[model samples]
Target: MTIDEQTVDKIAHLARLELGAQEKQDMIADMNKILGFMDKLNEVDTTGVEPLIYMTDEPNTLREDVIKQEITTAEALSNAPDHDGSHFLVAKVIK
Candidate 1:
């Protein structure tokens, strides 16, 4: 519909924005222009047109994930400076 200064002021207030007299007037004209453009778009006939999506027919062409067996615990703990049995020992962080 038509945008007025009062409508623009209400919108600005709702959005927690402060607009001066000139700014409010500018917003009204800009909003009316936007609404008029939308109205023009509404005149087009596209009843059977499908909604647009992000992608086309291109495949991902990604490689499959290769599952390898994990290393033994002893092999992992071998590099550690301090280890009790299963996990590495470090200084207590929490007090």
Candidate 2:
């Protein structure tokens, strides 16, 4: 389907865009060209072609998660400007 001025206006409004007269016309033309390209792509033969999901067949390799204590609670709280013996103190933000 071809893009018209009305469609361009609607798209611009949805995207919170403020288009000038020339810009709106340009958008309509660009959108029409994109649609035309999509229509051309539809004419291609793909009778038994499989959709590509990934570029490589190799499985993803990830390191296993290990739990280890890197620092004690006292060590973590040492540099705090404001703390209530065990926890950091901050001004109340929410009403």
Most lDDT-accurate candidate: 2
Clashing pairs in 1: none
Question: Per-residue lDDT of 1-95 in model 1, one digit per residue for the tens?
Answer: 89988888789989999999899888988999999999999999989998877578687789899998699889989999999879999999999
The candidate that achieves the highest TM-score relative to the unseen native structure = 2
lDDT of 2 by residue, 18-82 (tens): 99999999999899999999999999999899998988899988999999999987888899888
How much is the lDDT of residue 83 in candidate 2?
Answer: 89
lDDT of residue 27 for candidate 1 = 91
The local distance difference test score of model 2 is 0.92
- In angstroms, give how far residue 52 of model 2 lies from its true place: 1.1
